[model samples]
Target: MCWDDGMVDPAPTDTGRAPADEPAARPAVRIAVAQRVPPRYGDPPALRRLATAATDANGADLLLVPELYPAGFRLDTDELAELAESRESFAAHLGAVARTHRIAIVAGYPERGPDDTVYSSAIFVDADGTELAHYRKLHLFGDETAAFGRGHQVPPVCRWRGWGVGLALCYDIEFPELARLLADRGADLICVPAGNMVGYSEVPEVLVPARACENQVFVAYANYCNSDDEFDYDGHSVVASPYGSLLAEAGQDEPQVLMVDLDPGLQAAARAHNTHRNDRRHDVYRGPDPTIG
Candidate 1:
């Protein structure tokens, strides 16, 4: 059942199943996280740079980029509206990039929704240029509240290249409920496109891995490394395993791309030993009865 009424449960097609001839020991997926600052708002170079990054991630199955990578981060409401593009335009551009490079992508963009409202949004394009999912950032942080509309839909889990891939934005990753919801919906990997600042190093260092361990899913966080007009990003892009281990991490201030292989076996093993999801006491997790207190 959907926990939120606004959430549309995406029908997950079994596109990720391994064939009988495939070897069991083979890694399920290879992902690349690009931790670089894009061109400033309204700069045409930003779109070109994303395509270039896709080429850089040549052999990987998927590429995860930072939040608002098309437009510069730290925009006011006016700039956000001005910079936001229709989801179709963004998707088409991303599709071309993905098709050219033969790599699935989860990249952020400022979406110009109906009625000209803007949102901090991300889209997932399959390697074959099919648009799989679109997720607007749900939990806004700081200036984001004034800049964009809150997303009303829960993130969807899509089957892609032998994995159940899910999407979330920077601040959204910090909230345990969202990640748990994704896990419960059968997400094997949660990809976060973030714009975390210098003061929040622990998010990538501590919280991300914790989320992965708790849910028995791989979590990949891609963040900007350089400073924008208003914020200096921390740039510790990382990939965490189901075992809560750091598979890869980028540096604090340098542009980097981290590549890691995700083994489905790890998730199976983690679930075998740590059945946290199964151990939850849902009946006791409700709010206090208003009649009693």
Candidate 2:
């Protein structure tokens, strides 16, 4: 595991959370995050690289890649619209990769919606090549605001190999509300495909783990490294555990694939100790105060 200097290793110790004899409720799931540079638009070499990554991640239950990977992240609105792929075409390609490698995949792309609008989207496909969910990014970041239309629907939690997985793109994961909503709807894990550039290292350093710890779920953030014409991607891709622990991390300057195993016992223990879900003061949060109309 690649350790970040900021995060401490969560070695086992006596935390009075769960009893020693309790059985772990969920099976362990392994995930892989590909941290690399995305090829430019219309580059076939990029797809070959992705296939190689999938081939390399043979044993992991799921493989995640960066946001806007197919079309790259630096395109303008006109370029994005021109490059936007139909959902059917995206599925056919990614599904083939998923089946060939026998690994589930969550990847981001630009989609041409049926309404003639283009949106930033991500799709989840099981190992058998079945498309489970297609999520349009609810939050658009920076240049993305002008490049694509924002989504109206919330992401769906998908059931994959006994794990409840939810999908989010780069900017979406930064919203605590989104993560909390997913947790409320029974997501055990959230996979984020991000184009998190140089200035936003803090997102992986702080928010990612905080979201995981607070919600008692695993979060895997896959991002690109290296520079493009307009942006420099800071590859601090990470998998944060439910205990706010950094399970695995990739450095800021290199291309890497970080793999980690998710143990359900850890999540069970964290929830036992924190109990945030039970402790939330919803009535106070919802509000009907005499002072405020």
Candidate 3:
């Protein structure tokens, strides 16, 4: 189900199963991606409210919010230090909301580590207010490379209701190898929180779907809607199936939460039907120079 500026509809339910006597029944998971910019620096309450409203409006099992959600993606060191917060405190605030709404949340923020380096991060909080996973972005943006230290480790797979979920930040999705790595590691879904400009519409529209089709996994892309009145974002937040079909997409300029039901069985079938695996020749076929490099 999706609620965009007061419009709502009944979401499709998952009824397909792999077999009758399967040990685990494939559960339909509804996810909502909020495509909106966070409040300017030092407005944590407003940021919390936006996230809470998105969670309430969609009633989704998991809510994905964009990176630097608490403080507008600040590049200056002075600004970052002024706005950064402890991971524990930020998780507490989101945890309270998750507990109140009985839903899980994936919120992004700038984390000030003990070493005094700021890292772009996302925290997964369950309905019971428990912090499940913390994914620090591995690939940093252009200027971010100079401002923030890159994370060295890939985050663990997020498990909810027996589904293996992967986390990727903005530029991370641009790398096909990253998604392929996640798929190889058993990730059924990849959630990306991005802040893309007007020119990058093709990323979500073309590249994201291509990534889904090639990897045979679902992708949820949440992008910032508007920022600073000077920049207009392409708010094409989308959910793509493993078949590379767009399941849901939001408008170009709006604060919307799009909900989509995901079924792993469908993804598996799509991969099998397309012969994406059977057709590949890893040993002999060499990809283009850029792909190899």
Candidate 4:
């Protein structure tokens, strides 16, 4: 149901009950990544500093930060209850910063959903501080399954700077199907807010670029850069191109901001050259036996 017959896949439409605004794009955009001081449990101030640090320096058109640093990404349900922010509150706060900085921002927080559910969430605010996409993480990592509720909606694709942009987070980007789905649905950029742990070089080094190369889309991974009780986070965050070449990368263990210029024309050329998606043999591919099903 997600795919159709075509030499090129069609643009994706929002399928969930949640509302989505019309997508807008630009020819080129500048993206900035932040590796900042990890937040402590129940600290919104720390979260604010992280946001400011991302934009307070040599800012760009868009800013990306790691997942739920407000709770240090290791909170128990009780801790999360204290740290999670209401949507309205978060919007009011981040929107002001985005508008003042004149930079679109994508940052993570633990959202306090109705019924006391806590969802690891990412909020996207435009340069004018208009909230664009508010997405919850779909793939929960290890202990996070016990700590957080999973988001139901598929990652929606929005247009930014004349290119298709998809929303995803940490473990979500580790899955091939998710990225492929985004790409097949005409996503030119995949922005991830991740809290990737130490020692998984394959993820940032292999899977990230692999997704970009195979899908012919730009992938930006923003991660935390410290060791805490919950994670020994290694911050080798990067922006990879459609051709799988890295545009920018951060230090392995420091607080830094990595910036790069992204051109949609390059993505267009890569998609034209990479036939992986176009060459799929759907008829030859099948799922498990009905008995197993």
Candidate 5:
């Protein structure tokens, strides 16, 4: 991972809290995941304004933007670095937006490391712009592997408003083991920021829900809209319930913010009903290990 291991900062203290004797309100949480590719070259202020507008429009408790929001996925390492902004600056912008809108935000961007290596990373920013967590892409895609080093450690389960959230980028969702690991670590929800081309829409449409069903947790798959004619994405952003039911989905070839409500109690009930991974035979499942498939 490109993140600094020694940098362990606490979450922002500006988050609003309910009164101690308020009976712990069970307010419904609305989350919005944007399925739109950010403009390749635009003022960061404008982008932040757009994000704030969307959050306000949907009354979102949390907002998610697609991968590489600052820059379209550039293959060249130097190009990606040129597009990368300092974490402080990026967080400041998103934090302002989050604080203004009173919502948490998760955004993906290319990160330039101290050694000058670039890594695909996502940042979870609290309302005050305090960074809750940073997750680097463990599995690189296509030419990305050639450009960036693979992330080694799995990220910690993020805590937000009594919910445990997990993070993953594109291509990572294809690996069931990762999701299972997140679940094992007490994650109740997984947020995926992806860049899906035309032919790969089924991966999110079919595989995402299956992952949630098998893991018994909610999954939100957010993808980019499109670029020029050379790059077209089937924007099938989806939010699946713990039981694998499609709660909400964005249509193909459109820019949209899909909003869905997550119920942790319902997820827990689903897990109790069907303990798939929880009741497993690992002893027999661990066959002879081979590096090359």
Candidate 6:
């Protein structure tokens, strides 16, 4: 894991809220998050097998892979160009996996875009081999600025079985506004795919639950684990509930696929305790004209 003195480990400040009982009748979805995956050059068949086993073994309804799952996170243009996946092929392959496993899957890859750009992108493949939602990383991080182009728009919240799910990359969720925007749009859950390294492991432990609580939504953050030649990852994948509780977490250096339930009625019950979503004084804070909004 890479450590830098420039970045401090994040700590959640809102910790003392009174607890509320979650609704018992809420319908729940079984979700899973991956902590490690094959690198850029890994065999395609192997990747599919790993994903299949993950969903089948846990009977997970939805499975999320780390950011840039197929094409490694740190490769430069030349290497990435050779490894870049066309959106069509990426979708078709993952869609097939989803169909065979009867599990919805979220996978990330380096997508070749217009004008020779490659965007760090992801897609949600439904259980029936259909594409549900797609998103490009809106916020770029570290070496990503030079490796890929930035995305221009926010992805639409996906309607899954009855849950409204929002997607974001690693760094995007760190900025509260992104998750808040999704919550304001009626998102019941937010999914984050990350390439988190050491020293910055605090995100899943601290920031993820904070995002969930502040937005009154559930958050599943999946991260890459272990170290490669260029980087060492923190490997702590976690799922946080709207009540800021860490539902499940992986080890610092181990790879894991965690299965947890996200209950909408429970999220709504949590939101009942959290009225800030509608109570925020936006008039004083609407900084840029939403023409840019």
Cα deviation of 224 in candidate 3 (Å)?
Answer: 0.7
lDDT, candidate 6, 1-293, per-residue tens: 10112323223223322122233534688998877844745456535654654554367898988888876676578878877777787888788888878888887788887666898988888989898777888898778888888987755476677676778888888999888767655467788888887789769888999999988889999898887767888888899999989999989777788889777677768878987766765576766675663
Q: Deviation in angstroms for 140 in model 6?
A: 0.8
* TM-score of model 3 vs. true structure: 0.83
| Candidate 4 per-residue C-alpha lDDT over 122-217 given as tens digits, one digit per residue, 9 for 90 to 100 | 888788888777788889877888989998776766656656678889888889999987875657788898888888867888889998998888
C-alpha TM-score for every candidate: 0.89, 0.89, 0.83, 0.86, 0.84, 0.85
- Rank the candidate models, highest TM-score first: 1, 2, 4, 6, 5, 3
Q: Residue-wise lDDT of candidate 2 within 1-293, one digit each (tens)?
A: 21112333224224311112232756798899999776765677445766888987878999999987787786577777787889898988889888888999999988998886888889888888898888889998766777788887767776666677888898898899999877765678899999988988999999999999998889999999988767898899999999889999999988899989888888888888888876777678887875876
Scored against the true structure, residue 135 in model 6 reaches a CA lDDT of 81
State the RMSD for candidate 5: 6.7
**Each candidate: what lDDT?**
0.83, 0.81, 0.74, 0.76, 0.72, 0.76
Off by over 4 Å in 5: 1-27, 41-57, 286-293
lDDT of 1 by residue, 126-186 (tens): 9888998988889998777888989988787776765667889999999999998787776
Residue 175's lDDT in candidate 6: 92
Show how many residue pairs clash in every candidate, following the order shown.
Answer: 1, 0, 0, 4, 0, 1
Candidate 2's TM-score:
0.89
Q: Return the lDDT, model 4, position 30.
A: 85
Model 6 worst lDDT window (10 residues):
1-10
- Across residues 91-142, which tens digit of lDDT does each residue of candidate 5 receive? 6767777777778888887777667677788888877767887877899878
Candidate 6 backbone collisions, by pair: 290-293
- RMSD values for the candidates in order, in angstroms, are 4.4, 8.0, 8.6, 5.5, 6.7, 8.7
Error (Å) of candidate 3 at residue 216 is 1.1
Better of 5 and 6 by TM-score: 6
Best by lDDT: 1
